[model samples]
Target: MTAAQMTSTSAGDGAEVAAKGTTEKRRLEGSLGVPSIVFMVIAAAAPITVIGGNSPIAIGNGPGSGAPLGFLIAGLVMILFSVGFVTMTPYVKEAGAFFSYVATASGARMGVGTAFTALVTYYGIQIGCYGYVGWAIGDLVTAFGGPDIPWPVYSFAAIAAVAVIGYHNIDVSSKFLAVALVCEIGIVCILDVAVFINGGPEGISWHSFDVSHVTDSGFGIAILYALTGFIGFESTAVYRDEAKNPSRTIPLATYAAVLIIGVFYTISTWALVTGAGASKARSVALETVSGNANMMIDMAGQYAGVVVRDIMQVLLVTSIFACVLSFHNIISRYQFTLANKGVLPAALGVAHPKHDAPSRSSILTTVLGALLLLILVVAGLDPLGGVFGYCAAIATCGMMILMLVSSVSVFVFFRRHHEIVGNPVTTTIVPLLASLGLAACLVFILVNFTMVTGGSMAVSVILALIPFLAFAGGFVTAAASPRMRGRFMANVL
Candidate 1:
């Protein structure tokens, strides 16, 4: 990647600015070549598998056979949003991911708030995956006469394993994610092919893509839920420091990941509808899959034989683990970046001397994840419901905020910098409108979060408030810190 032009400012006395106020070295040593980039893309896209594996069943029940239309609508909206998102990457240089975009577009305080909110959201997601991994392992073990392990035990174990992987070498994690991703995509493709060949229950219907379905009440709800599955796709920019050619690679990966994920989800959701039959699809999904994690396995056994079913279950387990590893690396890197920037504690910025990895941050991330897992298990909540639902909701909110900020940033940057507008209608105006649309979506999801997740009002309220609280806490801490107080004020003014 081309190095960013370094600019320095000096005081009247000619002394250099404090290092805290300067940008840090591009210290990421790993080379995220095309293969590794693909891994990152797929890992971020893995939640789509879970969504397809689970939510389609719920959507089928709620929106009838028109559920695929929801995925299509969400995918199209994300595509439009990506146009603005990809355009802004070349203009921003921070590694705090979306938080950095917000900082550059808005101001230091808002940036800090965004960073803290993102940290909470990403960490919650990483920890949330532990519960999912544990639940999957626990179920698999129970089938084999193994001792029944509690969800927290499995979660803790997964957290420890991910920590080790995340703290050592980026290449190692990328390779592991690559293997799991191939397996996941392969299985999903196979299922789609089988569904097509067997023919749909009621044949392909144009109603599946109708605008009315897109406008349905449950359709918007399902689209919001479906959009969450694609949350991590934006992380491609997070790896800019490590990318081979960031300007080209980041934009390419960003757009490529979104399109690939959108296509995969669209095809898979359609296959699911056809496999279960249009009229009975919802009931079939609920009865056979939503409540039962093994629904895919059972379906594979019936249509594709025992071998495929067994292989799919194994791949599903690996996919979940890959997601854990991916998010662990992401959250740890965010901590490392923020710490290095003096926005967080310096201790988190330390990298392993030999490994050149953020070892300390990784360990701390795992510890936080373990604590969250323990708290949920002790509270007697369903691990999947509490961990995935809560974390996913919060992460979704954080990402939506980031997207909104990035959209406005695009318009402002172009306007202020006098950059020529290319296709202003599609690029600027449409995305600005989409930003407003997404903001409305965010508020709707937050207000009716319980309905979206099928959780109690209290649980939904708490989960929805957590991101805001994290943002507030970060702002308060930054304002009070002796180290940051001066810089914060200077940057704001």
Candidate 2:
């Protein structure tokens, strides 16, 4: 089959065609520029505020002051993976995202698996963010004399806001995300700088970067958790059809996003150590920040004055909301794309004729998020532990699997295409090794998921396995459908 006729099957019909030969007009506008791409990356990266603000507290108390080292190790591994990831972007030419890449490399079954896993992970994370937003908003509201609202109310409010924003033009959302991203990064940077200026009680310490600290028993687990903070970095490719000169923009953005997030995290974690004192950092973090992110603002107040602290608090809330907005867009798009490809119901594939956005998909995602919030509120579960924890764990598992599969797809694509063989490091060696490394990390995270979160082994195991099950479901469905099965293999191989 020629590459031109192998495009993805539409919801209405099942047929094999090569992607290269198909002349379907691109529906998405290439309106997103570098600034917009940067905004998307930052919006996706905003969740790190919560992760960084709390992880040290969890680890310092449970695992020790070696938390910073764990972050550094994870950063290094991600950097290695990014080297190959950026290299692979120029080769793949599909808007189906990672599913397209996996299809081209591993055939229809794996492509379906990849797409399903991504959908589960994206929506799970989106729903998960609602709980965090609810908790954060509840704290903010209670401080202002408002009644202590239930988490579901806050979550529902957040979903409503996101739905309104998400059903609009991409440019509008991009601009909104850009502003929120700046505020989030600025607040975090201020905190980091304050910690540095105040200096540690014991003075500067290099122990936070020590290899021994990173190799600790819980260090790998910590690293795995830390790695999730960078989960959305690879999504640069998700905008392939909507990016100007994607061959260049996608690869550069991918690498730049990874490096930026990694450095930001390493520096931020290190600053926290210095700000809180290496010896007492963990204790201070747990006492202050873990239960309430506002504690960080209080610390900033003591060290940098009340004005800065108040400003930071406002920014934190905005950051959390921005993440809610960003993930809503991502999850909705995943649904839209998958539905267009016939994996999901066609209703989800319908783009708003006027806005050109996936209106139904966005509404579905927002509704699901609101529903999850209601369930958690009714159950009286701690939004943090019950909702956020479960969602984060599930999302992490899904993202890790996606990364592993993409890395392997990179290797397979290069091996089969052969045109890129001259650059073995970029095409074959780097991704192959990165895939193996990520696979090991994936196994480690799965085995230790319960210990890392201090949750029940049964709960953690079930949550961690959801993405894999989603993938298996897709594979099964694809195998059972002759049209899908034929189209997948014919185009991919």
Could you tell me how far off, in angstroms, the CA of residue 493 lies in candidate 2 after the best superposition?
A: 8.3
For residues 260-347, write the lDDT of model 2, one tens digit per residue. 7777777777776676677877677676535544446656787678777767766766777887787787777777766656677867
- List TM-scores for all candidates, in order: 0.89, 0.90
Question: How do the residues 1-493 of candidate 1 rate in per-residue lDDT, one tens digit apiece?
Answer: 1112211111210112243564433256657876677677668657435544545544544575677777777787788788877776666654456766666556666667777888877877776677778888787778668898776777788887887898886878888898788878888788778767877667665566777776565666667766777777778877776778676777788777878777777777777777767776677667644565344565567667777777777677778888888888888888877766677677787667677688888888888888877887887878777676677767777777666766776666555544443567755786787688778778867776776555888877877788888788776776667566444323221
Worst 10 residues of 2 by lDDT: 9-18
Q: Using TM-score as the measure, which candidate wins?
A: 2
lDDT of 2: 0.73
lDDT assessment of candidate 1: 0.70
Predictions in order: lDDT: 0.70, 0.73
